[model samples]
Target: MRASRPVELVCPAGSLPALRAAVDEGADAVYLGFRDATNARNFPGLNFDRDEAAEGIAYARERGSRVFVALNTFPQPGGWRRWTETLALAADLGVDAVIAADAGLLRHAARHHPDLILHLSVQGSATNRAALTLYHEQFGIRRAVLPRVLSLTQVERLIDNVPVELEVFGFGSLCVMVEGRCVLSSFITGRSPNSCGVCSPAEAVRWEETPAGRQVRLGGVLTDCYRPGEPAGYPTLCKGRFRVNDITYYAIEEPTSLNVLDILPALVRAGVAAVKVEGRQRSPAYVREVTRVLRAALDACQADPDGYRPDPEWTGALDRLSEGQTHTLGALHRPWQ
Candidate 1:
């Protein structure tokens, strides 16, 4: 056995079937959320109810995999009780950890349920060691998920400084904005992604076929227009093409996914406790295939970090599932900054 423990493989579970697929595919842990605004991915038909969460947790535990409940969204002015009650529900469900972003929610979790393992969500946006220290000292957080904005060098530096465990995103959709602060969707749809749990929510999205091409609009504002043969992506404010200076281009960000298979060894060697896969909004097949590939890559890295190489088959599988059929290191590999 290696002297150090292997980095954990954390997977996403949008439903009970996804939870089972993850555990069966070799995930060390799976993270999910309740079907409410308390979690970030509050889509129309996603997330778990109380009984489903209980069953998922039970299934994971039976297979030696852990379950984390994401109460990761900020509670609105008068909605604080829902946050607290969900934390209570997490404890009652016997989940392994509670991932949260709100200061008050973390404080309550620390004070009221001292034994509960608190994980600072990526939405917490704690980029530096100082912020990690504050949360560790005040809220007793055991792990903190890093926002996707940090470069690989920054992540290594933070790991050397923080007292708590660190988790980083290894795969999934790339958010152009900082994790918890985007208000673009709310500005257009009047539904806050931070508290209401969706960006460019489904109801506000409209698709219509025009003679020029197929166009998609968010809250009646044209987000994107695609040629007849081109692929039409989901309409989101950030990923939309806008006309600026008489030139049409993706002003904010083009649609892409983050894939870190090439750097799995570097992260494993750098003392990261867990590698998280984003997308509780995806399907069970998505959860299964991603978990399968990452599990294989992680196991290989653990066995021999220096000699580890990402398998071609693994790369192909992830590429097929990637958003826009393209991938980037995201901010992990910086140009100059």
Candidate 2:
């Protein structure tokens, strides 16, 4: 059978307002995490409580938008019950799907709630077709969120080999390290990103003034220093400036967002089943703007396959709502230098 027409837009919803904004602006689905360690973006003041999640799900479904609950973090030893219970609750609350990364959690969801759709999280790092297929065989995963490491060509190849739906990140922050493969945060902060659902926890970030300028630090170790009028990026360890061969430069990646508005047609042709906009930490206005623009783009692509070009004006609107001044296609093309 020919591949399904382009893909739907999967937006993020960190709060009830964000969910409403996404649906109002036009999203086919929204993915969110619980206000606990079960989801990866578990920062303070983010995520929804159980009652709020149910309400959010109802709100989306009433508007013809689906909700996917992300129970994507690995369960801590001796704390698997929490993860298991969260999946059960999500099923009970009638989420359209549960995005999972951990094998144990996947097994639990499969056993207890076999009817629920399971989408593999990017944290699973299922980069190749073989790995993705293995998950399909073992856990009955309906979809796999392709990692940020594959190029458009590689994505096409992978899709040809796999027998499941594929979701690709269309817009968001770029992670230099492979998702779930990263241990840098744990090494520094003694907190596991895979288990705790947070990388570079906000409480661990600090800033101070130095004689030369100002210093941005993570867990008391200086990660970046900024002089007057210089732009200071978030002090994520992977994006920190470092010295090598007697010269200092950003060792992993510069602080930048990923804007693939210009490449949406290519991604569609590559057999992407869904285009995901990643920003659960973002504001409702951001969700509204992006969902609206991407919805229009997707509709245009579907309406005229051969004559579709994303609107440059929509891209500019997205750029205005982006996080940082720097933006890149990121590892989708090649490893960041």
Candidate 3:
């Protein structure tokens, strides 16, 4: 049951050091964004400027690793110029591919940089073969990162039917809603991940200490509260513990990491072109350890898929870095659905 081909390992690069860490730890490719609202993870003090991005690209290329620029944010009517400029800069830097979501931006990239590789971001929301085909035919997208909402069987079916390359989320935080389409954040905060490149932006977050517990609020709304010695989660409206029929709990989703270690072999055999690790806002140390562990796991699974089991040490290492110190199979396993 070993993999038929070596699946590419796509890691994240939030900063220059993280980019080096990803390459040093054997990532096949690293995805990053410019320090602007063009990319999805537009947090302060993160991402690379133009010069830093060039350096990162050079470092990765030297190690036989590819670098992808993420211009995944959609542009408003008046802001189309910025998205176009970001695409041009990414193409000029000789990036291996551009992970884009907006239709206009993709069309602009296809027309201006026809030779550059175009990868439809998960934000593009092409969950089925028909949508994938439309993107492939219209904009010449070579690959598409599937949203995490699909099950293992669904992914296999889409891969069997679609002509473009497929990439799936192997490990990372879980977003209950599909990427690019979630409007909950925008409703609560004045910003949206698709347009503003942020979710529960730090500027709008508030933390309060009380005798009862620690209270977390996002844009003046109580998101989560944790008692003494409890692991407090990030303040996101989706992962919040709320009252439902007199019981307070995480009704929508909990704060857990997505680890597909047990299903790596199935994904590889399903003809997945790549496995993406989603965390560009994490620290360099986080990037280093996660890349190292996933690289080992992927290599091990390829070598002996039938005999493969997730190493406890690797799981522990990732768990320490996980949100709420927990992990799940996400939507990959049907029973969880």
Candidate 4:
């Protein structure tokens, strides 16, 4: 959907190069996390250190783009200092906003650093207008990233009532469970995307070549077994093929990307403040291509909302980069639910 006013395009950046790619390719803002447990996507060899983050901020500011630091992970009892220090660093670096999920951390930011823009991360799990309003009123959050579990109707209604700005996922890998609340990964691996900043940590994954084919395991438990010529996906518990009622299939959700190109008009009419592309763990090249395609699509939608159609070339490019080489409307389309 072409909006009456231009909506911001928020892109992800796991590294400095990805940050540069996002801003250079027309992203209005690039979000990244520090290289620590305070942020999600705490995978090895990803994210930025203090120097790198400062460099990234400088690059974005020079390009007339904003930078958001993701201090989105919940800290454990003894780890409050890490989050607080990270927030201090972000403020010193002059970031545009901080995406945070923990209540205590939000309160701290509101009390100690009132000038910093606070954005409620999807990890906060604030799906309803009331939930969002509580965050806005309590912590003075300027925006909230909605969980990817709502239909367009629900999103539209929430936007009309919520006190703060709303950012919805435009394109990304689909999470079967509710964001920030899922514990399936934690049960299997002692790490989680919420607290430890990892889901299915690499150390917990095992791949074995079996007589039947190839077997993938998470925490040494069988998740899926793929035949020789078939595509085997990453070993996450939710996207794993399992047996139920004598059927071997994707019991939770399949490994498909979320593509909302057809629903941009509806989102625009619904008054969405921003559309976020979710791929901080992806390669810089992937970030560049995805940002470019979405930027063009949004422009095209604005040029002629009534005549807007999904560009085949754009769809093909995203599909080629998507997990399982496929994409879906996800929870945005009611039927997908």
lDDT by residue (1-337, candidate 4, tens digit) is: 1224578899999999899999999999999999989988898989999999999999999988999999999998799998999999999999999999999999999999989999999999999978888999899998999899999999998887878889999998888678989989899888899979988888999999999889999998899999999998888898999999999999999999999998888887788889999989999999999999999998888778888888999999999988899999898889988
Q: Better model by TM-score, 2 or 4?
A: 4
Model 2 per-residue lDDT tens digits across residues 302-324:
77767987687887887777656
lDDT of each: 0.89, 0.85, 0.91, 0.91
Candidate 4 regions with alpha-carbon error over 4 angstroms = 1-5
lDDT of 2 at 127: 93
TM-score of 2: 0.96
Please give the ranking of all candidate structures by lDDT, highest first, separated by commas: 4, 3, 1, 2
RMSD in order of candidates = 2.0, 1.6, 1.7, 1.6
TM-score of candidate 1 versus the correct structure, residues matched by position: 0.97
Q: Which digits, one per residue and each the tens of the lDDT, describe model 1 over residues 1-337?
A: 1114568889999999999999999999999999989988998788999999989998999999999999998997789988899899999888899999999889989889988999999889898989999999999998899988889988888898898999999999888677888888899999876878888899999899999799998999998999988876778788889999999998887787889999998898888999999988999999999999999999999899999999999999998998787888888989612
Model 1 per-residue lDDT at 11: 94
Looking at model 3, residue 15 earns an lDDT score of 99
* lDDT score, candidate 4: 0.91
Model 2 local distance difference test score: 0.85
Q: How would you encode candidate 3's per-residue C-alpha lDDT over 1-337 as one tens digit per residue? A: 1224589999999999999999999999999999989999999999999999999999999999999999999999888988898888898899999999999889989999998899999999888888999999999998999888899999888887887999989888888788878978878889989989998899989999988789988889988888988888788788999999999999988899899988888987788999999999999999999999999999999898898989999999999999989888888888666
In TM-score terms, candidate 4 sits at 0.98
Task: Count residue pairs with overlapping backbones in model 3.
Answer: 0
Candidate 4, residue 65: the lDDT equals: 93
